[model samples]
Target chain A: MDWTALVLSLKLAGATTLVLLPIGVILGRVLAFHDFRGKRWVEAAITLPLVLPPTVLGYYLLIALGVASPIGQAWQALTGDTLVFSFSGLLIASVVFNLPFAIQPLQRAFEGVGQDLRHAAWVGGLSTFATFRKVELPLAWPGLLSAAVLTFTHTLGEFGVVLMVGGAIPGETRTIAVSIYDRVQAFDTAAAGIMSAFLLISAFIAIAVVYGVGARAVRLRG
Target chain B: MGWAHARCGSVAEAGPGGAGEGLAVRLRQAGPIPLSVDLACAPGQLHALVGPSGAGKTTVLKAIAGLYRPQAGHITCGPAVWFDSAAGAWLPPQDRRVGMVFQSYALFPHMSAQANVETSLAHSARTERAARALALLTQVGLADKAHRRPADLSGGEQQRVAVARALARSPGVLLLDEPFAAVDRRTRRRLQQDLAELRSSLRIPILLVTHDLDEASALADQMSVLHEGQILQTGTPEEVMRRPASERVAEILDLSPGV
Candidate 1:
């Protein structure tokens, strides 16, 4: 079974989830409450990953972070390492691909918190940050948990975006999904089946935790 | 009773210059209506804003609380200028030192009554927070229900918790939007009496928004009759009830032709 690939996949998903959670929360709050011109366009752009082909997103990131680009050149100059075909590149690719999975649930959770509770907290003399921490975070924990789980599972199952950006480098970017495809190409049916089953079981457990345990926790709190 | 006396003493110590200067609001327009109101409530006094459901009464309270900004106006509570459109000074709700109880009470559903009250005592020391919150809940007659969440409390109990939470900071002004609209008649009467006693103890201005004429007449020291976002009449409740400025005001008050 590709244990190296399995470990790499978990590492990538863990890193991506850790990075995406805060970004998702901040962006979700903005989307949930604040109104500004072009907000709809911004939302559409954020959600584009949910519908757009993963390779298309990967292709854009490839050009944007490639050695020829200014960002890539600056990154290379600063770190003496290129972004393309690196674990860092794969992590960014996974985050972008899983952006909607991280943000949508969080945004819904914040919206569900409603303006009344926020207003109450404000009038109660709590600062904005305090209110978000005391009231919003507690109330929106279930949705946040769901968002985190979805981001983690989605990153673990990433195939097209990682394939496009990371290019199946062994022990570095060859995630489980990529390894499964490589196993099939190599006519290694047993290895492919093992990896696929592992991914399927992980997805099921993550989803069960979110729907079964998370919902019950929220209900019990109420 | 001890809590009330303690609060009065604290208020006096906070401002020795007598009851702190009251809340004054002058707004050209607020909310969706072309609202314009120039009203004031003296310290230690309860001013009721009486109007129909959509007559901008709650909007006036929100503007004073710094929750809603008027297009052209200033709200001055005590010595602080909460909003001044021309000077571009606007204090957000958190900085305004204003406590507001919505019609629905709007308590934090997940928190117990004590936690809800403690949240308002942000300036209190962490060690003193629980005691202070408990004292305030006792003042509102909810000391026993301090550990109960809003969902578990009755409407009157929840309202008392909201009142306790609002009073936790000794706010410069208190705004109540249809405070008794949700309670039963007996509970409403008791809450009204409790509020009246509370008003006597609190030196800061109190603004009560309600559509019920009886509520305004019973509790308010000064009453303003609003119609279509305009103050149609402003006077003592008895004066307003006895002799409305116009037929419209009388009709809105539901006063009989002779009375």
Candidate 2:
């Protein structure tokens, strides 16, 4: 097992999950409650990265951040460095790929919080933010937590996006997925098998903890 | 000192249900439509609105509570303009000092019984909120259940918590929506007596909406019969029953010559 690549994968997954959690909450609540033009289109757009070909996504990302595109130039000017072929770039790619995993469950959960509860809150003189914090958030906590866990695991397993954009740079963007790919490509089946075993065990442990906590919360609520 | 004393004397001398003494809610929503009703509950009296389901009885209550925006009408409670569609003056529910006990008992299921009651107090100190809530629970005979959740309580217990919550604000007008319907028969009778006692102690006009005439007669000092979104008659229960303003009122009252 490549310890550095393993640590890098963990860090990337952790960072992606942390960044996506608040964004997922906002997106889920908006999609669940708000009525607006182009909402369906907006939802489709958010989900597109999940289904889009990873190579095509990587190509677009590569081009957009290659210092030729206006966005890339602007970003370079702001950060004094290019985002392409970096750890940060891989993190961004993983978040985009796993967004739907973080959002769909939460949106469904929030939608299930019936309008009667919200109407009662309105009559009670609660402001919109207060109602969300006090009513919607508590009701949707289980699904939101599950979404977070799912996105984290999905990000950890992400290979195609990281491979194309991250370029498998050793110790910088060489996540465990890319490291395993490297071992396979080099015909080192033993190392590849070890990495695969670690990934499987870690993914299983993460999912088990998530479901365990979610089940406990549901039981308590009942 | 003399003029002030004289003024106080004249104010006190006015008879019960005198001009500007009780709530007057006459509201119209939209179009040429008009939804109007009038009542003068004497101090320390229970007034009731009895009607079949979907008679717009809840509308009338909501209008008075400032939850409804009427097209045209005025609601005056005592000297205050709760809602005057003509004058365009409206007071919010919180400002009106009106306590409402909802039909579903709308107890905050998340909070304990005491906290639910304490919600009525705007400026209640943390220490006093619990004490005052407990006192109200005791008055409603649920002091021992103050720490219990509404879900843990029986239907009757939930209703008592609702009543205690309504009284927590010391409202000038208490609106009860089928307050006794949820409780079992034994609890209902006990609650009825407790409500009557509460009415006397609070000395506030009570407006209760119910479909049951027996319950209305048992509790109301004044009764209004409504049918199909209109008031058929308003009078003392005996008078309304005996000399109904319309045939519908008579039918609704189920009045008989002997009774």
Candidate 3:
């Protein structure tokens, strides 16, 4: 019933997906291709958010983006505003939390593109950038679509990190997930049930699209 | 008429002492076994590199193509120095002007046959790219199949498309790594004939890697017998067939000592 929160949640999810896609692609390509010292450490650090408790991640983000920190100080200096408890803070937190979801699938897809095709492109007189665009991107499109959808839906349902970082600013940060919790705490079970159902159905449809359409694209390519 | 005349002109310019000065590869300690190979192929010649599996045949091709950096030595194709360890000059594959046909025919699966060839003509004028791609496809007898993706093409067709795509660059050297290993005998013969015609028309140095002795004998102007990452013999097909350099070379070639 809280239309504002639903719309805000959608906006946050969209912004988070837009911000994460390119970072995910670059990180995925690096993880897929390059071999270097401490690569395992880099990989472990990237995947840490997936296994860490959401509240733990939220705790770090809160400290890191607080007015006391260097990043927060720089933001305040430039924009005359604090980063903590802001919509931008929520977007950043969601990107960090959903990174593994975006990157792992893309890494697998780039790997599936294989070195042979890249070498062939090189021998065909295509530059590295041209080859990535002409060959890797087209071949790995399904996985990229899956990554984008996963990031979007995951951010939509975000609760712990959003709750910890953004709190409950009704018009600004009270997403659908937080609104459901607020309704339940206020003993408004009817409102909570409606919001929860909406989320459940949205998640289902997003997942179905990825599986039904994305998987078919991958299969057709193979 | 313009394209055909241009093609002939390029071919004439590439003949013997022009753009077809040939490829000279002197590589050392490149792969496993401290491989050292000294080989050359002149213009208008098909030099076959015959060796058993793991004998570093593909390594030689990669070295020539600038995909593999040799520990010591140089790779010169026509007038360009692709790699020279002493000069510390190394050209990447995209800059080396070398065309390679992989054994698996590494065509872009998402691209049509024409687009696959067009990727090689990235340096060509944008207005003439499609026409040039079509001309190369026609040269390989695939003009009608230009719109077909690699998945829709047969194995022989895929190989031909790869050849056309390689030739689209007008490379100074051509490297075929087991190009016919995947097709049947009839398709293999047809592809071989097509390649022979391509060689005669292009007049560029071509180095072919094959395990089949008959294929080598039938197509190669000269054959180099390699074993354990070393060139044991280099001579005409009849010379190597009639007189292998040593017992090991003979054994590797599967030829009787008396023969």
iRMS (Å) per candidate: 1.7, 3.6, 1.1
Q: Which one is best on TM-score?
A: 3
Q: Tell me how far candidate 1 lies from the true structure as C-alpha RMSD in angstroms.
A: 5.5
> Any runs in candidate 1 off by more than 4 Å, and if so which?
A217-221, B1-20, B30-33, B241-259
Q: Across residues A130-187, which tens digit of lDDT does each residue of candidate 1 receive?
A: 9999999988888899999999999989888898889999988999999999999999
Docking outcome class, model 3: medium
Clashing pairs in 3: none
Query: Which candidate do you rate higher for lDDT, 2 or 3?
Result: 3
lDDT per residue for candidate 1 within B1-259, as digits (tens), equals 7545443443223332222367777788745677878787778889899877878998888887777787987877766888888999999998888888988788887899999999999988999999999999888878888898888899999899989888887799999998888989899999999998889999888999988877887888889988888998888999998999999987888842112
Using DockQ as the measure, the top candidate is: 3
lDDT of 2: 0.77
What are the per-model numbers of colliding residue pairs? 0, 6, 0
Write one digit per residue (lDDT tens) for candidate 3, span B168-204. 8889989999999899989999998888777888778
Candidate 3 lDDT tens digits, A167-201: 98987888999999999999999999999999999
Model 1 residue A147 CA deviation (Å) reads: 1.7
**Lowest-lDDT window of 10 residues in candidate 1 chain A?**
A213-222
Could you give the DockQ of candidate 2? 0.15
lDDT digits (tens) for residues B1-259 of candidate 2: 7544433332223332234455555555543334656555655778889877777788888777666667776776677777766667877665676777888877765668887777666446667877888998998889899999887888898998888877877777788888887778898888888887787777677899988787788888889887665677887887887788987787777742112
